[model samples]
Target: MNPVSQSRQSAIFGKRKEPHTVIIARGDQIRHFTVRPWIAAVAGSALAAVAVGYLLATSYLVLRDDLIGATVARQARMQQAYEDRISSLRAQVDRITSRQLLDQQMMEEKVGELISRQQELAARQAKIGPLLDSAADLKTSSDETIPTPAPRPDVRAGLDATTHSTLAGFLPDLRAGSANLSAADNADRLFVSINQSLRSIEADQMDRLKSMTEKAYRTADAISNALEGAGLSIAKGYGTSSVGGPLVPLDQSMQFDAVVDELDEALTALDTVKEKARQLPISNPAPGKQVSSTFGVRKDPLLGTPALHAGMDFRATTGSSVRASGAGTVVTAGWNGGYGRMVEIDHGKGLTTRYAHMSKILVAVGDKIEAGDIVGRVGSTGRSTGPHLHYEVRRDGKPLNPLTFIKAGKAIAGLI
Candidate 1:
C-alpha cells in the first residue's frame, strides 16, 4: 500500500487506537475485563481530589494550634503588664495615703501647741492683767515709790476686752476680708497668725517678768544693805522648807506667780528686819563727844597695871547730859560696886547697855527710855579718875566693844 493511502485509512478506520485489558483471579476462579482511557483518567482525578483535601485539613489543624499558642502567650504578657501596672499604682496610692496622714498629724500637733499656749497666756493675763492696769494708772515719777491699786469690777472683763485689740492691729482678720485663697489655706494662715500672737504675748510676759525680777532684786539688796549697816540680821525664807503632797506640775504662769510671791516675802522680811534693827542698841550714846579711853585691855591709870577695860569712855564736862543709845527700859538705876551711879537699860534680845561713872542718874528702875533721851550726867565717880561718860554694851552678859556699836550706828546714821 502507498504511504499516503495508508495514513488516510488509519485516520478513518481508527487503526491507531489500542485495546486496554484487565484480569482478576480469586483462588481458582478467574475473570476478564476491558478498560477505557477516559474511565482511568476519571478515577485518577477522584484520587487526586481526596489527597488535596487531606493536605488542606492537616495544614488547617497545624496553623490553628500555632495561632492559639501565639494568642495565649500574647495575652499572658499583656496580663503581666497590667498586673505590674496595678501593683505600682497600689504602691503609689499607699505612699500618698501615708503622706497625707503624716501631714494631718503634724497639723494637729501644731494646733494643740497653739491651744496650749493660748491657755497659758490667758491664765497669766487673768492673774496679772488687773495689777498691771492698776500699776499703770497709779504710776509715779520715782521708781522707788509704790503705787496704790485701783478697784475694779473684775480683772477678767478688761483682759477679755483688750486681749485681741493689738492682734487686730497687727494681724488683721484673715477671714473678714475678701481673699483669693481656698478656705483651707486661709484657715492655715489664720492658725499661723494666732501662733505668732501667742509667742509675742509670751515674749512680753518674759520681759515684764525680767524687769520685775531686777527691780525686786534691787529693792531686796537695798534693804539688806540697810539692815546690815545697822548690825541686824534677816530671817531666812522658804528655800529650806519641804512639803509632803502630790507633786503638781507648775506651768510658766504658776512659776511667775511663785517668783512674785517669793519676792514679796523677801521684801516683807526686809521691812521687818529693818524695824527690828531700829530697836537694837546700835546708836551713839554721847554724840560729838571726844573719846578718852577705848574698850580693851589697857594699863590702869590708878593701879599702874594692865587691866581689862570693858567700856568706852567719852570725855565730857561734868554734869553733861548722857543719852540713851537706843529705845529700851531701864533695868537698874542705882549705885554699883565700882561704877558709882550707874544705869542699865535692857534693849531686849538678850542685849543691854550700861551708863557708869555718872554724876547723876536720871533714869529710874523700870523707866522707859528712848534714843537720845537723857539717862544720866557725865561725872568723875567711883573708880573714874576724871570727868567722863562710861558706855558699855553687852550681849548675853558678855561684853562687846562699844566702838563696834558706834561704827554700826554711824553706818546707818540717816536710815531708820
Candidate 2:
C-alpha cells in the first residue's frame, strides 16, 4: 500500500494507531499530552460529577434560608393551635364550674324552705294534740257508732314519693362519689330529702287534724244528746244573752284553714250545749241524801192524806248542805209557810228550781249562783217529821219530774 493511503487507513480503521496527543509550543519549548480512551472517559465522568455537585451546592445555599423560615412558621402555627385549644378547654371548664356553683346555691335555698315548712307542721301538730285529748275525756255513751273519716291519698304521692325514693337510692352512690362529687350534687340531694320529709309531715298533720275534728264533733254530739235527754231543745233561743267577736284573719293553707274552722265550730257547739245544760235543773241539790218520798201522787206524811207531791223529799240530817240544782240568780231566799228557809232560783229560759225545808238560808235575792252551790242547810222545820230537803224542778211555773234532770246531769258532768 502507498504510505499516504496507509496513513489515512490507519487514521480511520488500522490497528497500529498512534496515541492521541495534544501539543503546545512556545519559543522552542513544547509539551505533548496523550490520553487513553478509558482515561478520557473517566475524566469526562469526573467533570460531570463535579458539575452536578456544584449545581446541588448552589441550590442548597439558595433554598436553605427559605426552608428554615417555612419550618419555623409551621412550628409556630402548630404551637398557636395547641394554645388556642387549651384556652377553649379552660373556658369550658370555667363555665361548668360556675353553673355548678349556681345550682348549689339554688338547692340550698330550697332546703331552707322545706325546713321552714316542716317546722310549721310540727307546731300545728303540737297544738292539735291537746285539743284531741280534751275531746276524748268527755263522757257520753251511745249505741250509735261514730263514723270514721274516709281514707285520704297521702300528700307524699307522685312527685314527693318519687323524690323520696330517688334520694334514698342515691344515698349510697353519693357516699361512694363523695370524693369526686361537687357541692352542687350534695346540695341537690339534701334539698330532695328535706322536701320529702316536709311532705310526710304535712300528711301526718292532715290525718291528725281529721282525727281532732272527729273527736270534737263526737264530743259536741254527746253534749247535744245529753241536753235533749233533759227535756230541753238546743234550737230554742237563749234568753237575754249576747256574745260576738270579730273574725281574725289567718294566713294559712286552704286545707289547714278548713280543719281549723271545723274544730272551732265543734268547740262552739260544745260550749252552747254546756251552757244549755247549766240552765236546766239537772244538778243534784243534796248529793248524800236518799229519797224519802218521790214526786207525784203519794200519801202525805204530815197530814196522812192522799195528795200530789210536787217535789221529791231527800232524807238528810239537820244542817246538811242544800245546794242549788242549776246556775241561776236567786229570786227567793227566806222562810215560807210550808217550806221553812226555802230558796228559789230563777234560771234563764223560763226554768226554776226550789230548795225547801232548809234550816238556814245562805244565799239572798239577786245573788248569782252556779250549780252545786251551797245555798242553804236542810231541816224539817215545817210540816216535816225528820230532817229532809224538798227539791222541785219547774218550767214556766209548771212542775216537772226531777229524776230526768238528775240523770241528764250525770251524763253531762264528764264533758264539762
Candidate 3:
C-alpha cells in the first residue's frame, strides 16, 4: 500500500464533516438550529402532524360544547338570583305601600269615630239642657219674694219642706239617702268625694235646718192655739157671738214677725248651703306641673329688658308631651299669637286652665280632656326663649297662682 499526500490525508481523517444549520424565527431574536440524521430519514412526519391536528380540533369542538353548556347553566343560576332579588325588593315596596295605605285608612276611621262621638255627646247635652234650665229657674225664683201662707206659717217649716220636695236641694251632691236631702246621698249618687269631711258637715247643717224649721212650726202653732183658746174662753164667759178678726191674733203675729224673719233668713242660708252642696265641683288633680320659670317680674329673654312676667314658664324638652291637668271640655286649641300653641280646658266650676308654648297641638276645640292626658307638645313658641310649657290655672277668668292648684293636684294624684 502506498501512503497518501498530507493534504488529502488531512481532509479524510483530521476533521469530521460539518452539520447542516437552520435558522428559527423569534420575536426580535434569531435562533440557530441543527437537524439530526434520523429527522432527515423520517418521511411521513407531515402527514402524522396533519392527522394529529384534525383529532385535536374534533376534541376541542366537543370540549367547547361542554363549556358553553356550563356557562349557560351558570348564567341561568345568576339570572335566577337577580330575579329573586328583584322579587324581594318588589315585595318590600309592596309592604311599604300597604302600610302607608293602612295608616291612611286607620286615620280616616279614627276621624270618623271621633266625629260620631262628638255628635252623640252633643245630643246628650241637648237632652239634659231642659233639666238644667229648670233647676236654674228654681234657683232664680227662690231668690225672689217668699209667699206668705193664709195663716202665716213659720219660715222654718217652709224651708224644711223644700229639702224633701225639691231635687235642687238634693241632686249634684254625692251622699247617702235621707227622707230629706242628705250630703252622703248626693255623694253616693255623683260618685265623687266633694271633700273628706264634707258629708259630715252637711249632715249637721241639714239636721239644724230641720230642727229650726220644726221648732218654728211648733212654736207658731202653740202661739196660735193659745190665742184661740183665750178668745174662746173669753167669748164663752161673756156669751157674745162674732168671728175673730186678724186683730185678735195681733200679739202672736207681732211676736212671730221677728221669728219669721229670723227663720226666713235661716232658710235663705240653708238654701245657699244646699246650692253649694249641689254644685258637683270636683277638682280632678293631676301630676305636679314642672315649672320652667316663675310668675311676676323677670327680664325678657327676647327684649333683654325687665318685664312683669304675667305667667310662669315651664321648661320642657321640645316635643315633650303635654298633659291635661284636669277633666274638662276643650274650649280652645290652636295657635295664639303670643301663646304659640295653646289649649284651654273649661272645668264646670267657672275654672279653666291655659296651657301654652306647645310645639304641636294634639287636641281640638270641643274635645273633652281627661286628667293627665296628653294634649300637646312642649316647645319654645309665643314670646319664649327655649322649649318649655306655660301652665296657668284660672278661676272665673282670672289668672291665679298655678302652684297652689298644682300642689293640690299632686296630692290628689298620689291618692288616685
Best by TM-score: 2
Summarize candidate 2's per-residue lDDT along 114-214 as a digit string, tens digits.
54575666566565555555455432443222222222223231232244334434345544555565555654665565566566656665665666566
Candidate 2 ranges beyond 4 A from true positions: 1-25, 28-60, 115-187, 236-252
lDDT of 1 by residue, 80-123 (tens): 99999999999999997786555455555655665566566666
The TM-score values for the models, in the order shown, are: 0.47, 0.69, 0.32
lDDT of 3 by residue, 1-416 (tens): 33567756777886654566899878989999887655755646867888999999999897998989999999999999999999999999999778655544543343344344344434434533442343332233332222211211111222222332242333334333444644334323332232223334333433443455444344334333332332211111111346565654445324434444445544444344333222211232223436657776787877889986655666667888777766779999998888888988886667778888888999999997776679888888786778888877776887766665554333323222
Q: After superposition, how far is residue 216 of candidate 3 from its true place, in Å?
A: 33
Residue-pair clashes per prediction, in order, are 0, 0, 17
Query: lDDT of all the models against the reference?
Result: 0.71, 0.74, 0.55
Task: Pull out the clashing pairs in model 1.
Answer: none
Backbone clashes in candidate 2 total 0
